[model samples]
Target: MAIINCPFCNKKASDKSAVCGNCGGKLGEMSVEELDRLQRDKRLALGQSLNNHAMMSLIIFLGSFAWYYYREPETDSLEMYAIHGAMLVGCAWYLVTKVRLVLYKRK
Candidate 1:
């Protein structure tokens, strides 16, 4: 049997086993073709998430601008306040989501 390095722990293992005996890490179980497929999926998911974040920011910016312009001549102080409040909430939500994703991935 050919010896190969484990992808997870970098330990050497025979190609015949499904996992590395040294670290119990799965090795050579996923074919190169499967790894490529998973990588493509990950890239697509990341791209979609990034696009979603950009869209959210754009929406928030446009909403704030519209709120400011619409109430500028009406002498309504609440409009600007509402715009800033909404923007703050949206930013907080985005940050929380980002932090959660990072923490979850660490495990």
Candidate 2:
């Protein structure tokens, strides 16, 4: 294995390690250009995920309002249905966003 200086602590380390053993800073396995590309891709993915969450939230809010205003005095079927649907959608959106964030953080 090739010897290289650790980016974190400036200690000697093997090129194969994914992170600096001394101070735990990342030592990328890929070439500089490849690492840059990966970072860009990650950023784009995060942006897309955030956008999806925002859109879902907006949809749920509007649906809730519509359901509330459309309710009749004697019947609440429509309102209940809309609320249930919105709750399900909101939960799904929350779970997906959380998972994406967790995966990105691990990488």
Candidate 3:
């Protein structure tokens, strides 16, 4: 049997399954409109999750910025390097997530 993503819960299930293993949703009996609605809901949920991640990344970036300014870490020091790394990673992650959201919206 082939494994496939369930339209109801986006979980792995057998292509031969009549019901989804994760969500216990009837797979074979669902109508086209129902499947379309479920897919849209899944897309929306993913977008919202991505937005939450973007918000968290922004918060991390801001926190790191504030910490760096407050401490005034010495140049070439471990603390300075760590703070810079965090700031860079957080900013990059936020930007990537935003871009992904945009791409997803276009779909």
Comparing 1 and 2 on lDDT, the stronger one: 2
RMSD for each of the candidates:
8.1, 9.1, 4.1
Off by over 4 Å in 3: 1-26
Q: Which candidate leads in lDDT?
A: 3
Model 2 lDDT-worst window of ten: 71-80
lDDT (0 to 1) per candidate = 0.67, 0.68, 0.88
Worst 10 residues of 1 by lDDT: 71-80
- The local lDDT score (0 to 100) that residue 27 gets in candidate 3 is 79
Please, what is the TM-score per model?
A: 0.49, 0.46, 0.75
Q: How many backbone clashes does candidate 3 have?
A: 0
What is the alpha-carbon RMSD of candidate 2 to the true structure? 9.1
Residue-wise C-alpha lDDT for candidate 1, range 27-84, written one tens digit per residue: 5578866645655666567667856775686577667777777767344567667887
